[model samples]
Target: MRNRHIATALLAASLLLFAAGCKKKTPVAPPPPPPPPPPTVVEKAPAAVISSFTAEPSTIVRGEASTLRWSVANATEVTIDNGIGAVSASGSRQVYPTSNTTYRMTAKGGGGDAVAAVTVAVTTPPPPPPPPPAAKASLEERMSREIQDIFFDYDKSEVREDSRATLQRNADALKTILSEFPSAVVSIEGHCDERGSAEYNLGLGDRRSASVREFLIQVGVPGDRLKPISYGKEKPVCTEESESCWQRNRRAHFVGVQ
Candidate 1:
């Protein structure tokens, strides 16, 4: 009986040891999958973009037309400044600018707004300066203004020493007239002082006019361009009897005809 009791106790202890060794371990549940990586946050960018804004002819002259082309991406609204109102997202328009101009486009959407610009250069040349006024054409009048009357000493048919420059100027004026108008004609009138008698003064005037004509011929003037006539003392510029007045009355006057 005591052996039987000892065997039973050993069997009971063995069974308890076996039960403790075979028991299943409880799972740690994989640490809750690392908390699902903190629910990753995401950010979104704007949805609108200006694809293109361009001018077909960037430079244009006044009164000319240019085309403005534009395109947008993901835009709900589009507009252009400078009189261009709402327009399609992608389209073109003809623009006529009298002066330099700048065109801007605005694209709007839920995400953001985009802006773009294009310039259409306008070049307007200034009006040509007024044509220069036509040149004047009065050669004889010019010559008359340039040459002075040839004066003579009282009752003398010979040219005075001081009168040589005057004669040369007259010759130059006559040459210019003839060069410009080949068919031009001229007349030289001679007068004498009041101290001489009418007939005597007439002869003196004739001699004085002949002397002038001869001098002009020697200075390269055509003979046909010269004609001499005597007015004598009848047409005196100064009627007084003083020496100064008489000297003024004796002169050779030139007249040009075309």
Candidate 2:
């Protein structure tokens, strides 16, 4: 009985082992579709290039104007510094700066960024003020300076022997002026001291003025050019009551009329 039972156990174990060997092993999966070919990593190209950046007139005077220009390629974004925001890829702008300045431009794309720069120079400005006008002479000063005045002795209307030289000089000046300006006219004024009465001095002054005018006419000055007038004691050069002052007050004055 023990032998028969051992034989049955051995046969059962043999059939189980053969069945396990005959079953097909599970097929291996194809490696999860190779992880979708690693998702195809693609590299992008570089950013835009700045072809040129320049100022039309790099050197400018103060308060003057200049144009800034630039050109870029293959960029998606462009910007300038110094208060300039986003801008086109290529363009120009007018700028007026009080001082020298530098400008920088930047370009950006999917790949990277690019940069460029330009500088504008400056010069000295014009002077703040103009030159002053030239000096000129006045007409009144010229007319008064040309003619000479003649002096006289105290209370005398007669032509003095010592006064001939002065009279000759006055006559020569008048003749020279009349020859240059045919229409020029002059006046001879007679003056006296305050010691005499107004009425008596008037006659003395008239005689003195007539004497000067006659001498000028005799020396070839036109009579019409010499107009005679009398001031009497009305106009006094010296107010002091003395011989010297009185002598100075008694004189003939020459004045231009035309």
Clashing pairs in 2: none
Best candidate according to TM-score:
1
TM-score of each candidate structure, all chains considered together = 0.49, 0.46
Candidate no. 2 TM-score:
0.46
lDDT of 1 by residue, 165-199 (tens): 88988888788877877877787889998888999
- Stretches of model 1 off by over 4 angstroms after superposition: 1-134, 137-140
lDDT of each: 0.86, 0.81
RMSD (Cα, Å) of candidate 1?
A: 18.2
Residue 153 alpha-carbon offset, candidate 1, angstroms: 1.9
Residues 1-258 of candidate 2: C-alpha lDDT, one tens digit per residue: 999999999999999999998896777776555545665555786668889889879989988888889998888999988887788999998888678888888988767788998887877798877655454323234345555556677678877887788788778767876665566677789989999899998988888999989888888989988889999999998899998888887888887755
